[model samples]
Target: MDLKPLLNKLEHYRSEKPNKVFTMYLNTDPADPDQQGGKWRLQLKNGLNNFESYLQEDGDSDEKRNYWAVKEKVENFMNENEMNLKKSVIIFATGDDDVWFADILQMPVKTAFFWEEEPVLDQLKEMQETFPKTGIILTQKDQIKYIDADLGTVNETNVYELDLDTEDWRLHQGTHKADSNLGSGGGKTSKKDEFYERFEANRYRWYKSIAPKLDKAAKNHGWERIYLVGESDEVNDLESHMNKTIEDKINKNLLDHEETKVLEEVL
Candidate 1:
């Protein structure tokens, strides 16, 4: 969901004449829900009382009217909506149906409000969903999936699982020279080197194809960093072939996780 519009609305309020911001703070702790709510209920009542008294004493006409409407709107919201998981901190400006802002939190705050020119986003600090994250790449011989733990989302399909290559990328065993005495060991060594050259080349080709898609996903999918996780050989091989730009963004936090149960563990 987009919050830029609400943020823009907040900026509009900041620019309005006779500027005044109305804040409503609700403190809560999931550890002791009932008692925490009881404490904050009193704080809310007292904060509302302070706002009402401030409105009465205010000398500015435009701010007075706006805050008067804000006081009423805030009271209406409180009466109509219960303070639950998502409605941790709800702020409003006037009689508008939409609230100024709301934050989802599971942490404690000071439990207060300010009728000042500046709008506070202190609640954002306590919300994990608001923080930046790294894009986690889950890959194996068969699949490649991108997910972000901070945002709690996964791609619908694996990119590598799609049609890419039909050639064998795995190294195969080659027979050694029949005699231990030095003559044909060079032949054995040459065959082993050839197998590795082809195997490594194919792996790099696969990584080259997947890297650009990852770069696009990181740019468009909202992650500041990237991580790689899989078997050591695969992860390291992919890393070597990644674009330098993507390599710079990699956090290299190789997660030791099961590919089958990754979503459960990473999230």
Candidate 2:
């Protein structure tokens, strides 16, 4: 896509909301791209202020530390911006329970897509029941397709689906193409690579079909800024992988826009 125009538009918007704060979700999974090599820590070290840490001696301590560290950074950012406690957007990954906590705290909540798992669907259904007004965004193609099928209709009035490529925003660079990497198992040597290759390919296809819907949802929400906390590259490597930049995409796609700040760990 031609990104220069979008970049310029985002720059204009940034000039207007110099203090706006946006948040991104991070997948707390230790092996998630956002958590590898403690990259999220480095990204948040000096930026967050209000956060809670999980203290555990088991192998799960790392996970707890990561979650608390991010919470602290986000709290700090919110304080610094003096975000309207009621209007601030809190972005969460698919698996974080904190998403629900943020809502209880009275902060506005937004989420990325959760796929076909019945467990996740049940969780989503519960969340929707609790926060009927909350904004839940979807970017996975398969999830969108399933939702559309189940709903038996396409409603652009409230939800959004964008036409961008999910791979560009989700997968690590170069992992999408076919090669020997396609089926070589990374673990347990029995067709592992092949399994991952197929998995990656399927994910890529699904994302492509869903990006447009996500774009529409983001635009419809008229969010002033976006905050993300997740393991996916769309929430992690957004600045580098997507040529237009997050700030720009917000300007082009979101409403009442100003700036986009991502508080996330390096994936």
Candidate 3:
């Protein structure tokens, strides 16, 4: 998920009263031993109670009422998304609903709570740093797949296949039609060899043709880092053609792997 707009909003937030914003980061990972019996529920309950009890003792009536309103909202959100919980949940809200942000993230987070004048964004900023907006280009032969990701999750995917007829790449959709020109039987091997030889001869030029397209994609999608994954020669040739600085290159063909597994292997 993109955090630029959200971070900008939170950074500029201003509440009429002190401690008006409520921020929460809860770890609800089921695999964690500390969370084995749905322990996050208990933690949530206790955390909310602690804030309410403290407000009851020292806060004015308005403060107490606002806290209660935010508390109820947070509880309702958790209840609605309880079944769909990921590794963690984050929220930032106010009594008047002037600012409300909530997300269930695939990555884990440290559990914490805060009632302050502005949103708590330390953890969020750290996550953004660790997993910034990235573009993963998986290239193999005449095909390329682009994976756009942010904050450790996939946002969009696109595939491009080279059109030998035009010597240019085109965005591919649905089932790709098989090549009808590859000779059958004994001539199949010869046709395949000839095709490979032609591709090898024009490899640099073909990659150069699409370099600008990839650069545009990175700019349009706000990719902070680029990764090229494929054979060493292909990756090196593609990197040489592109103007964007590649964060890294993996000499492994992962174009046909599952998205999740590819992420695990690359990131």
Model 1 C-alpha RMSD vs. true structure (Å) is 12.1
Q: Can you give the lDDT of residue 195 in candidate 1? A: 51
Candidate achieving the largest TM-score: 3
Q: Which of the predicted structures, 1 or 3, would earn the higher TM-score when compared with the native? A: 3
Error of 2 at 219 (Å): 1.9
Error of 3 at 166 (Å): 2.2
Measured with C-alpha atoms, the lDDT of residue 247 in candidate 1 is: 23
Q: Write the per-residue lDDT of candidate 2 for residues 1-267, one digit (tens) a residue.
A: 122332243333321111222234322233445556644444444333222221233345544555455455555654564433322223332123322222112222233322111112333334333432212222222222111111111122222232234333322121122133323335547565554565456654544444454445445444323333222533333323222213322112222111111111100
Error of 2 at 196 (Å): 3.5
Indicate the TM-score of model 3.
Answer: 0.87
TM-score of each: 0.53, 0.22, 0.87
Residue range with the least summed lDDT across 10 consecutive positions in model 2: 145-154
lDDT of 1 by residue, 206-238 (tens): 766676677776777666656676666767766
Q: Residue pairs in steric clash, candidate 1?
A: none
Q: Tally clashing residue pairs in candidate 3.
A: 0
Worst window of 10 by summed lDDT in candidate 1: 172-181
By lDDT rank, best first, the candidates go 3, 1, 2
- Residue lDDT tens for model 3, 32-63: 99999999999999999998898878858888
